[model samples]
Target: MTAAITATKAFGATSTTDEVLEGVNLAGKRVLVTGVSAGLGVETARALAAHGAEVVGAARDLGKAKGATEKAFGKTNGLTLVELDLASFASVRAAADGLVADGRRFDLVICNAGVMATPSGKTADGFETQFGTNHLGHFTFVNRIASLMRPGARLVNLSSAGHQMSDVDLDDPNFERTPYDPWAAYGRSKTANILFAVEFDRRHRERGIRAAAVHPGGIQTELSHHLDDDARRRMTEVVEELARRPGARPFSYKSIPQGAATSVWAAVVGKADEVGGRYCEDCHVAETIDAEGFTFAGVRPYALDPEHAKALWAKSEAMVGERFP
Candidate 1:
């Protein structure tokens, strides 16, 4: 489904979280925001909580998450913390089980936690670090809590424009047979995130659950901590090239509130259901680009394929040793 509300100049590339959520009240709603210890996750949770939603901030360090939530939401009346570590299947399962034990239902699940281009490594379960932590980890977590989603619940997966760098290679997701390129692996994982949302929406929309993928605009966040001096230079050159494109807004960093805008927009915007199974950016469904040079914006066609999404979902279930059903 396409968005009922088309992209408008009013909410442009520089829109902030509070701007996107203006006048939208989320009273009595329950939201789960992963990786809320810092960066976009914290801002996403903060914005939602400020609008009166019960926000659960999931992170690996509960103490740090508490402090972060306190800082973001002040007294933490509308915010809570849960322990989760996407790199570990055990941690993911434990977190989900605990949430289930609480008998709470979530109106939205935002998979906002992820590691970007990092050095080649394996997750605790022997999967590639980027793909494993960013894709499979969220895959298992979502499946485990599938039944707890309230009717009309939305699942928002945080993808990236970096997905244009590569497509998923289902046969060697662990990098066992091919040389590992950190950027390519990150791209594949981001693509997987988009595809996961596509398949998820297809499977669950009938049950009143819809999913969407979001590419939060480029921001200088902790997610870039792995970049070295040379890596940062290369990224800067790419962004500069993107800025030079005709009619393109110059590439610029976003504040935490700005980076979290699309996410909050996807989670609660009234017309979001119309755009289920699509990738979004800048507070609306992103355009599809087919150019050669760095476009820096929009979703790639392959990342939205339903077939690729289904295949990845099956492979993820096998790798994690759990079936969604």
Candidate 2:
């Protein structure tokens, strides 16, 4: 039997991106990050570039991405933008194929682009919005560019604690029959993110390519913009109750740097074998929590179930209408 994965006490939810990446040098490393137009994506790219890595930022709007990076990073030492709309398979294929054609190897790939609590809608390809953009888009793009990942490279999928909300519904991923609930849909997609990493790790470990999923903690970024005032207030109350501490405002969730810490930590700082095929948060490997209701920490067993990961992989290939050998 394999040894268990454990968390590192070196950093927790409060650590910032720079803190986790403090002493690491990435001079010759190249990384691809999605959703760099805003939020953790921009921050993740900035932090990585600040540490000397060549960062290729992907966004639906190149202009917006360039503006955001300029506003955030100020100086672009090793940063460039790629147009990618995760909600559409055509765009996904084009972007991935372009990278493959370029034949540039990447040391890390951070699937950081995603939407949360989005309205009921289908992707350009007719898949559910959250699942299509967050899970399937990354699925197709990553697999297509699999050849460009250097040996010993790693893939980081930005999952969430919201994954505790629901598991993947392979029978009805499109919500054709089930009534569409925003959070549940978000949960399913996030859960899919974890399962994808698990399966990807299994498939590529022999080639030294590892994958892990992480929750970047909560930050009031563009990701939560879909929720209105009432929804936002309710979310705040839930977080307050979870914290069980007085004056636990939602605004106190996490700073952008702190929020992006786990992404960089998992991608380059953490122990590769220990983090391979696992779900992490707060810059450490989270324990597997098997219980009802949201404990607000650790990962659910279903998110790490190997059989479930395999099942999702098969289903994803079918949904995307392509199989990766």
Candidate 3:
């Protein structure tokens, strides 16, 4: 399967992150962005900080994160670095516990750190690498920090259009019974991200907490670290071949800043006040797509199924051995 293509107008397709957020003032607002050491994470943090938000840059490597913060903010006072490695449940617990202990409130929590197709690997907690860090890890983190998010707070899960590749297989999510394919595993994790938002919103919307899953348009980033040079080259060829196919709508690749647009928009947009549990792409709520292949576009029906959302939530709780409010 290909990416989920959406026709919805992007709020800032060609615009840089700073431009889309030009007039928004996040002064005194507190934001924490995972994966902030580089790529879209840095862009997201930079945009928030540029708008005067007190940005907490969370990454696995504190040193790299600090350096990235400096590069983005230039020794500014608005950004701080926090250590977080989502693959380790202990790390997630420690990070959230620290925040909870601080008695601080957060306006936004961007669950942005994620891994792509990689060789079969397990997290410190014995879960699949991508699913562990991308979905279940974020799930545990959000639950721990739920009390810290004030009413009207936003939680953004960085999902991908790659979700179209597959749905959550509750019976064998860790690939114990089924054969493991890197892309399939990634797709399942991405689907978990969407369902997490759906279930979270269903439970928390009345509390004024909303959740959104977003597909940042593809950009050349470090998120593909799991792919070797040969694999990367093959993917590049795939994209090029798909682009050249007759009548094929070329995939619109975004620059790093543009790739971060949808995330920033979902995070800070005033208009998104009532929007929750929806999958968004290109900065707007995506349409539903039924077809497959590289040109595949929009959210599929299964992706938005409330029943599946509940089921996935229950399964996730059992898998992670934690409950979320």
Name the candidate that leads on TM-score.
Answer: 1
Top lDDT model:
2
What are the lDDT figures for the candidates, one per model? Answer: 0.87, 0.90, 0.82
lDDT of 3 by residue, 137-166 (tens): 889988898898877788889998779878
- RMSD after CA superposition, every candidate: 2.8, 3.9, 4.8
Query: Which of 2 and 3 is ahead in TM-score?
Result: 2
Per-residue alpha-carbon lDDT of candidate 1 for residues 19-110, written as tens digits (9 for 90 to 100) = 88777778888999999988899999989888878888899888887887787768888887889999999999999999999989999999
| Model 2, span 88-134: residue lDDT tens | 99999999989998999999999999998888899999999999999
Which residue pairs clash within candidate 3? 5-296, 5-297
Model with the higher lDDT, candidate 1 or 3: 1
- Show the lowest summed lDDT stretch of 10 residues, model 2: 1-10
Quote the lDDT for 172 in model 1.
90
